[model samples]
Target: MEIKDLSGMRKDYVSEDFSEKSLLADPYLQFDKWFAEASLVEEFEANAMVLSTSGSDNRPSSRVVLLKKYSKDGFVFFTNYLSRKGREIDENPWCSLLFFWPHRVRQVRVEGVAEKIVYEDSLEYFKSRPVISQASSSLSLQSSILEDKERFDKMIESLVSSGEDIKMPPHWGGYIVKPERFEFWQGGTGRSHDRFRYDLEEDHSWRISRLYP
Candidate 1:
């Protein structure tokens, strides 16, 4: 197989221009607006976001997670508490979430502190999941090394045959990121992108600023 070298890959962003004056005072509202637009696009997963977390060792890791919900409170996503990212969040609650919409040449970066949501909330979400998903989540040991596929299959088989209600694992739940900062980016032609950041103030008001890009 010949190795292909591709150094000339780029796309000129000609999407609608974003301006500071057009942004909402509240970052959450602004995010909602962008998300709603993204949702209307059939080709994109509007709720998918990259969650980045750091551990006590200061090593950072990121993974793609679905945004289950969002509001004035924060962005919510579910995961196994024993997962690598979960442990990292336990060690260091501060994290960042990045949402990239390449089709629209837009991105949203969020920095916040993550905390596990209440058990009742987790249970409600868990119950809404399909039975297969519930079974897999309950039986699977996330972020753990798997020696063989047989064991995993057997566990799922047993869970299915037992006909027991698949309950949420004690270590499985949702986490909400309480954002303190948000940066919205819109790609532009000539590599001159539009960037705006909203910082939460002590008085609970958001201060917006435009950045050179």
Candidate 2:
């Protein structure tokens, strides 16, 4: 066995300064702009984000989930309501979302309260998914121990070939995270990063402040 300690490794980021004058007054709009840029520059799924949640035990869990939708209201992602993350959200609604774009040398953090969207809306999105996807979601017991991988794959294949219209399970739907705060970070040279935080105020307005990095 070999142990490696290459602490000297580093990646320098040289980019335009993200100043206040260039920032959008609305944090949502600023996120939109950066998201668009990331979409163009990122070679893979730009909407992939880290969803972090803490359960009743106060143990934090993090997983990468695709961002299916977003707006001024909040961000949306779907999953089995009975999954681990889903159960955690039920126990504690407070969660945070993180988006990192390495190629763009940027990242965004969001702290929010998650709530299930309307069932009808979830059904609508479910119906819009491809038949195979719908079948997979319908058959999958996410976050559960997979006793038989081959059996599970066959089950999904069988369902997809049955020619029956798969319905979204009652235990499966979407959740929208209503953000209370947002932070945007841009990488800088010499290990100096640019960071800004947007805090929700009593008047439903945002208080944007720059933070030391």
Candidate 3:
């Protein structure tokens, strides 16, 4: 059988509502609650998110990455510093994070500037990773073009043969996206949606208000 078009096969929602009255004063707090709910649900890849970044020449690129942690400080994720995202962050620290939990019809968009963590912090996290991932961290020069696909495997094998502890590559690390603004969107039927946004105030507090969605 052949696959058919989905343009006329959209589904309707009969789930729940995200009301403005129930929202927390701080979007981060509300996000925490929703994230907790999503974590326990059977949603597909609950921690997966689309991270968008702008390059030095001003083009945009987005890819799915697993969110490692989130707190009042911001969202955190790890990446090879030599990857495309790393180069972009090195050029422009600003970026956006989009999280969608379709099972609950909830989504969140965060705009923030990223800052790299200190070596000590990166080291702690690096040590926590499984051995294979640590080996991969040393294999690829990240975004660099591969002359041969086997290079990485050979490199990993070499590292393993050397029988030494894997040290986190200098070009591998973590970044924290300290959110200045966050937009929460809950889906509604027939194009009607609910949106609430929270922005940081000058005094280190939060200002939240509803938005037309």
| Tens digit of per-residue lDDT, candidate 2, span 147-201 | 9999999999999999999989999999999999999999988878889999999
Candidate 3 root-mean-square deviation in Å: 2.3
What would the TM-scores of all predictions be? 0.95, 0.98, 0.91
TM for candidate 3 is 0.91
Steric clash pairs (candidate 3): none
Quality of model 1 by C-alpha lDDT: 0.92
For candidate 2, the C-alpha RMSD (Å) to the true structure equals: 0.9
Off by over 4 Å in 3: 1-6
- Specify the poorest-scoring 10-residue window by lDDT in model 1: 37-46
The residue ranges of model 1 lying beyond 4 angstroms of the native Cα positions read 1-4
lDDT of all predictions? 0.92, 0.94, 0.86
lDDT for residue 36 in candidate 1, whole number 0-100: 88
RMSD of each: 1.5, 0.9, 2.3
